[model samples]
Every structure is written in C-alpha cells, then in structure tokens.
Target: MMVKVDRLSYNFGPHWVLKDISFSLDKGEFLFLTGHSGAGKTTLLRLLYGALPVNRGRAQVAGYELNKLKKRQIPQLRRKVGVVFQDFKILPRRTVFDNVAMALEVRGMPRPHLERRVRAIVRAMGLETKSYSICERLSGGEQQRVAIARSMVANPELILADEPTGNLDFDLTMHLMDIFKQFHTYGTSVIMATHSREVLDCVPEARILHLQDGRIVTDSEPGLEEDVQ
Candidate 1:
C-alpha cells in the first residue's frame, strides 16, 4: 500500500478537524477526495505529507509512520512525496525552467542531466516556449501548469494535489485532468482533493472518498450513492 490510515484523528486546540478516519491506497491507485471547504480534505493531505503531526491513531505513507516521523527526516520524506497546492505555489520571480528545476537541483542532480529532465517535463507540460518567462507574468492556467510541472519534475512515488483545477475553466480543467491521468497511467499514485462535479464526471473509474464535517461519509465509485459512515 502507498498509504494507510488506521483510526486517524487530529485537532486544533479544542476543535477537532479529523475524526477516526481510516483508509488505504494502493501503489498505482487514483483516489479523489471530495468535500466542502472545511471537510478536512486539505488537513488529511497535509497529514499524509507530514506537514501536520499525527495526534492520534496510526498513519503511514510510503512506508513511513507519520506519527513517529522525525523533524530531521521531513526533507527526505518530502523528496519522495510531491504536492500540488491549491494556490499554485510557484515562485513569482523565477522563470518556468528555474521553478521546475529547483527540486532536482536540491537533490544534487548534475546540471546537464537536470537541464535535460526539466526541459523534457516543461515540454511535456506545453510550457517549452515559456521556459524563460517569469511566472508572475503568466496567466492563471499557465501558472497552474507550471506548478504541476514542478511537482512532477521529481517523479515522486505519490502525488497529493489540493484542489488543483479549482481556478481553471472547463477546457483548462480537462487538460489538467488529462495530464494527471497520463501520470496515473505511468503508475504514480495520486490523491486529489476536489469539490468539482466536472472532475468527478471526467474520472469515473477513480474511487471517491467523500468527506463531510471531518468524517468520511462515502467511499465508492464515482456516482454511486453508497454511504460508508
């Protein structure tokens, strides 16, 4: 399994954000986490990536127990798990190539090999012409693509995306979904949090984990009405 959560729970001060959640994801599986704005989707993703400490129960990702993960091991953990933020967290002043290449550079990849890899990924994302363009000057869709390119540049085993297509139009959202599907076809596990019905319709085969009020109320194929709570 790529991820496993057994009776996981989390809280902020006196407020509980997640409650006794349990689920598992296989190595190449694509799972969609659907919920309203505060349904704990983002929090669950954060927990999986070690951004938030596990306060109760067991949670393991990529073979590492998040509850026992050390602060010093965070960088190593992040290297194997890529994340795409809802905000498209690309550096505004950096060029497209630089943004995508940063991850490889941090891993001490040789400059020549790094350039080849980054260029190939940028081209795959249809951003080859904008390789030297500053991110802030790009449109919303372009910036979102740049962010996806950066996350995928390292070819991590698991990708956690939080509302990746929230700001995109119908065309752009479908385009991004196609890109994600291509990656999934190559055996990368993906967990995307979204509230878009269009996304659900596009990936009918993917499993849906519907969250409500910090609890999973459903986990089944898209469009099925089964309630798992």
Candidate 2:
C-alpha cells in the first residue's frame, strides 16, 4: 500500500478538524478527495506529507509511519512522496527551470541528468519557452503549472496534490489533467484533492473519497450527490 490510515483524527487547539478518518490506497492507484471548503481535505493532505504532525491516530505514507515519524526523518519521507501545495510554493524570484530543478538538486543529482529530467517535465507542462523566465512574471495558471512540474520532477512513489488546476482555464485544465494521467500511466500513485467536476470526470477510474466534516461519507451515501463544484 502506498498510503494507509486507521482511525486518523486531527485537531486545531480545541476544535477537531478531522474525525476518525480511515482509508487505504494501494500502490499505483489513483484517488480523488472531493469536499467543500473547510471539509478538512487540505488538513488531511498536510498530515500525509509530514507538513503537520499527526495529532492522533495512525497513518503510513510511502512506507513512513507518520505518527511516529521523527523531525529529522521528514526530508527522507518527502523524497519518497511529492506534494503540490494549494498555494503554489515555487520561488517567485527563481526561473521556471530553477524552480523545477530544485527538487532534483536537493537530492544531489548530477548536473547533466538533472537538466535532462527538468527539461522533459517542463516541456510536458508546455513551459519549455518560459523555462528561463522568472516565475513572478508568469500568470497564476503558469505558476500553478510550475508547482506541478516541481512535484513530479523527482519521480516520487506517491504524489499529493491540492487543487492543482484551481487557477487554470478550461483548456489549460484539461491539458494539465492529461499530464497527470500520463504520470499515473507510469504507475505513480496519486491522491489529489479537488472540487472540479471536470477533473473528476477526467479520471473516472480513480476511486473517489468524499469527505464531509473530515469523515469519508461515500460508503454510507451511495447516491454521492454533493455537486463536487
């Protein structure tokens, strides 16, 4: 399994954000997290990627025991699990190539290999011409693509994305969806948090986990009628 959660829960001070969530994702499987804002989708993704410490319960992501994971071990876990933030955390001052290449550089990859790998993913994202352009000058959609490219450049075993296509237009959203599907075809496990119906339709094979108040409600409610936005 690429990810496993058993009775997982989290809290923010006195307010509980997640309540006894449980699910497992097999290796090479693609899963979608659908929920309205504040449904705890972002918080759940944060716990899986080690951004937030597991406040309660158990979670194993890309082979790391998250609840027991040490601070020093976070970098190791991250190398095996790629994350695309909802905020697009790429450096604004850095060029597109620099932002994407940073992932491999942190791993001490050789210059020749890093350049080839970064360029390939950049081209896939349709940012080949902007590879040398500063990210601050790019539009929101372009910056979002930069974040996606950076997350995939390292070829991690699992990818966790938070609304990757939120800022893109219909045509660009479909284009980016194709790129995601291509990577899934290569056997990379993916757990994407999204509210777009078009995005869900694009990956009909993916298992949908609808989160309502941090609980998986799809099993009890087979009707699955919440708009998905």
Candidate 3:
C-alpha cells in the first residue's frame, strides 16, 4: 500500500479534528478527498506527509510508519513526497527557476543536472517563458503553476495536493489537473483535497473519499457506492 490509515484520529489542543479515519491508497491510485472546510481534509493530508504526528492509530505512508518516523528521517521521507498547498508557498524574491530548483539544490544535485530537471518541469507546466521571471510578478494562475512545478521537479513518488486549483479559473483548473493526471499516469500516487464539483467530474474514475465531521462517510468510485465507516 502506498498509504494506510486505520482508526486514525487527531486533535488540536482539546478539540478533536479527526475521528477514527480509516482508508488505504495503492500505488498509482488517484484519490479525491472531499468535504467542507474544517472537515479535516488538510489534517489528514498533513498526517500522511509527516507534517503532524500520529498518536491515535496506525498511519503508514510510502512504507514509513508515520507514528514512529524519526526527525532525521523526515527529510528522506519528504524527498519522496511532494506537497502542493492552497497558498502557493513560492518565495516572492525567487525566480521561477530558483523556486523549483530549491528542492534539487537541497539534495546537492549538480548545477547542470538541476537546471535540466527544473527546465523540463517548467516547460511541462507551460511556464517555460517565465522560468527566469520573479514569482511575485506572475498572475495567480501562473504562480500556481510555478508551485506545482516546484512540487513535481524532484519526481516524488507520492503527491499530496490541498486545494491546488482553488484559485484557478475553469480553463486553468482543468489544465493544472491534466498535469496532475499525467503524473498519476506515470505511477505516482496522488491524494488531492478538493471541494470543486468540476474537479470531481473530471476524474470520475478516481476513488472518492468523502469526509464528514472528520469521519469517512463514503469511499466509492464513480457509479459505484460503498459505505465506509
């Protein structure tokens, strides 16, 4: 399994944010986590990426036991997982190339190799012309593309995207989603948190995991119903 969660629950201070969440994702599978705001979609994604600890139940991602993952092992785990946040998270002072090359640079990748990889991903994202442009000067859609390119430049085995298309228009959202689909087709497991009906409609064959009050109420595929407690 690429991801596994059993009887998982999380709390912030005294408030329970997730309750007995359980599910599993396989390699190359695309999963859509759907729920209203505060339904714990972000929390769940964080847990998978090791941004938060797992204390209540078992949670495994990319073969690492999240509950037992050590601090030193986090960087290794992160190198294999890409995350796209709702807030672009690109450094305003950095150029598009720099933002995307940061991850490779941290890995000590040589300049020639790093540049090639970054340029490839930038071109793939349709931001070839903006490779040297400052990130802050780009439009919302362009910034979002830069963010996606940054997340994907290192070729992570799994991707966790939180409302990646929330700020994009119809055409841009579809375009970005198609890029994600290409990644999925290449065998990367993807878990995206989205509330957009259009996004759901676009990937009808993808697994749908619906959360309500932090609990998974449904785990089904398109045209098929499965009740998950």
Candidate 4:
C-alpha cells in the first residue's frame, strides 16, 4: 500500500478534528474524500502527507513512518508526495514556467532537465502558451492549471489534492479531473478531497470515502466492499 493509517486522530486546541480514522490506499489507486465543511477532510490529507503530526495514532506514506522519520527525512518523504492546494500558490511575479520549474530546482535537478520537465508538465496542463506569462496575469482556471502543473512536474508517487477543482466551471472541472486521471494511469496514487456530488458522478469508477464529522461513514466501490471487510 502507498498509504496506511491506523486509529489516527487529531485535535485543534479544544476541538477534536479527526477521530479514530483508519484507511489504506494501494499504489495507483484513485480515491475521493467527500464531506461537508469542517468534516476533517483537509486534516486527514495533511496527516497523510506529514504536514501535520499524527497526534494520536500511526500513519505511514510510501513506507516512511510519520512518527519515526527525522526532520531531514521529511524532504525525502515529500519528494514522494505531490500536493495541490485549492488556492494556487504560484508566485505572482514569476512566469508560469518558473513557477512549475521551482520544484525541480529545489530538488536540485540540473538546468537542462528542469527546463525539459517543466515544459512537459506545462504542456500537459494546457499552459504551453502561458509558460512565459506572469502568474498573476492568468485567469482563475489558468492559474489553477499552473498549480496542477507545479504539483505534477515532480512526478511524485502519491498525489494529494485539496479541492483541486473547487472554483471552476463544469468544463474546467472535467479538464482538471482528466489530468488527475492521467496521473493515476501513470501509477501515482491519488487522493482528492472534494464535496461535489457532481464531481463524483463525473468519475463514477473512483472509490468514494464519505467523511462525516471526522469519521468515515461510507465507502463504496464496485466489488470492493469485500476488500473493506
């Protein structure tokens, strides 16, 4: 499995955000975290990616024990997980190409290779023309694509997205989901947090895990109910 969580729990000060949550995902599996607001979907993803400490239980990603890995080990772990946020985090002053290429640069990819990889991802995200344009100049959907390009350029084994398609129209939303599906096809495990039933209906084959008030209430995937048991 690419991810494993056992009896995981988290609290934000006086509020218990996640309680006794447990789930696992195999390599290349695509799953959805669906829930209403404040249901802990974001918190769960943060735990899996090691952004937040697993305050009450065990969690592992790509075989690195979250609780045991050292601070220096975090960079290695993050290299295996690509995170896409609902808000585009690209630097407004930088060009699209520069924004996407920053990840490769941080990982110390050589100049020529960084250019090649960033261009490939930008093209894949349908932002080839916008590559040299400043990020602040792009439209909302285009900016979102830049964020996706940045996330995917790393080619991480696990892709974690928080509301990747939250603010787009139907067409753009489908386009983004198709990009995620491409990542899944390339053997990257994908877990996305979304509340839209429309998104679920668009991708009916994806395993759906419903989170309600920090607990998983339903898990549905054709012929996989037995696996859950």
Q: Is candidate 2 or candidate 4 better by TM-score?
A: 2
In candidate 3 the C-alpha lDDT for residue 199 amounts to 85
Candidate 4 lDDT over 23-132, as tens digits, reads 99999998988778999999899888777887698998999999887888888898889998874378989999989998898899999989989988898877889889
lDDT of each: 0.89, 0.90, 0.89, 0.85
Decide which is better by TM-score, 1 or 2: 2
Q: Once model 3 is optimally superposed onto the true structure by TM-score, how far is the C-alpha of residue 221 displaced, in angstroms?
A: 0.2
Report the lDDT tens digits of candidate 1 across residue range 1-229.
9999999989988989999999999998999998878889999999998988987989999989998899998898889898998754889999999999999999999999999999998998788999999999999878988998999999999999998987788987888899888889999999999888888777777999989988888888876845322
Off by over 4 Å in 1: 226-229
Best by lDDT: 2
- lDDT for residue 95 in candidate 1, whole number 0-100: 100
Judge candidate 3 at residue 221 and give its lDDT.
93
TM-score of each: 0.94, 0.95, 0.94, 0.92
In angstroms, give how far residue 20 of model 1 lies from its true place.
0.6
Weakest 10 consecutive residues of candidate 1 by summed lDDT: 220-229
Superposed by TM-score, candidate 2 places the C-alpha of residue 122 at a distance from the truth, in angstroms, of 0.7
Q: Measured by TM-score, how close is model 3 to the native structure?
A: 0.94
Tell me the deviation in Å of residue 47 in model 2: 0.4
lDDT of model 3 at position 213: 88
Q: After superposing candidate 3 on the true structure, give the runs of residues whose Cα lies further than 4 Å from its correct spot.
A: 225-229
